[model samples]
Target: MKPLSRVLSRTLFYLLVIFVVVYSVFPFYWAVISSFKPSGALFAADPSFLPLPFTLEHYKSVFLQANFGRNLLNSLLVAGGATLLSLVLGVLAAYALGRLPFPPRNAVLYLVLAMTMFPQISVLGGLFMLLRQAGLFNTHLGLILSYLLFTLPFTVWVLVGYFRGLPRELEEAAYVDGATPLQTLLRIMLPLTGPGLVTTGLLSFIAAWNEYLFALTFTVGDAVKTVPPAIASFGGATPFEIPWGSIMAASVAVTVP
Candidate 1:
């Protein structure tokens, strides 16, 4: 390529990278800044980029008035439970598909992938009804199961690729030495796949934490509301106003840790 063309390509690539980073991070930065400002400043027409003076009133109000502490705990429990279950099931399923293939393995994998494509909203009413009937409605179990509908498939796929990339000779050798397949899997395969497991677990946890539709549909009371729905349901200080500062504070809190 010509020097000018190469320079242009480099410029374009840098611009694209910068654009993507700003796109993802700017909202987070803005939220954190806004959260520290008072309500008037948060909604200022000429918003200041730098929070010259910061305050924790919003955070205090969120914790004290909104009962965000309890809601946060619920979110932690639901997301944690879902991520754990999905990680365990995803690892086993991915292992079977990647290493110990059974008949029609590809077909089953494709079906699971297809199931992930279905919109979560499409099944919301049915899920709500089923959970209500089973007395799991407004419960942590319901939210965790609902989140699994989103997390499990991608986790399985990620783990499958990671497992498939592994050296299988060790596992076969283990089995030959009278180690059961489960033993080989637990003792050998899992250790080799730690990074991939961590990656998938993080993705699953983020998905469950960010999920909103199922949480809203299944839980109305404080008993089951998670962070997303709790942050969303915020109305302003005057019964009907939007508590923009508190909402931003809660959002920053959620994104931080």
Candidate 2:
């Protein structure tokens, strides 16, 4: 009975995993397949799982007509810039909070955590005004700065946890060997926390990449708009008709990365 129960449990676990994988992956798969189908097939009575007649017209439309290449570049620039800045600042802040015995350290850390809990919408109006006054409105710099609100807190928090988990003796040894604080961090702590750095940076990048509210609110021109807004702008000749094929194609293109 024990052996039978064990076998059944393993089988159930595998089946659950398979179900989760399919549920997560099917939408992306369907988008890719639908993107390849011609516009007519997209509106047919019966939808096909696979593209019976594959065409590149939608892909071409996205690149040539919609100018998605520019949008893609904008998103990369914004996300990359935000990630870089967040990592640099977050590392310094986390190291200080985690390693130093300064007064109000816990207070500062808790304050950072609290900032993350606030809804972004709560600050959008003030941020918009501030961006305009600072001459950052409608610019990549503006978007990058706005993204820092969330990314910086996240990076700092994650790195602080990682830094605290690191052995103190390594840092003490570096100090005894005549290493400066910066050198100690660069030579010892950073390398040890490489996984934490990668995890935080990747999360920051994805957050900035998918951000739509600030992208839509801050920018007016297509030249600086990210992929989220660019994809949202995909439309048909009239309000009544939506271009699902082109939208799906652009979605698949953006999602591939």
lDDT winner: 2
RMSD to the native, candidate 2? Answer: 1.2
Q: After superposition, how far is residue 215 of candidate 1 from its true place, in Å?
A: 0.7
Point out where model 2 deviates above 4 Å: none
Each prediction's TM-score versus the true structure: 0.92, 0.96
- Highest TM-score against the true fold, candidate: 2
**Candidate 2 similarity to native, TM-score:** 0.96
Rate residue 185 of model 1 by lDDT.
Answer: 84
lDDT (tens digit, per residue) of candidate 2 on 1-257: 99999999999999999999999999999999999999999888998999978999999989988779999999999999999999999999999999988999999999999999989899999999999999999999999999999999999999999999999999899999999999999989999999999999999999999999999999998879999999998889899888999999999888778
Candidate 2 backbone collisions, by pair: none
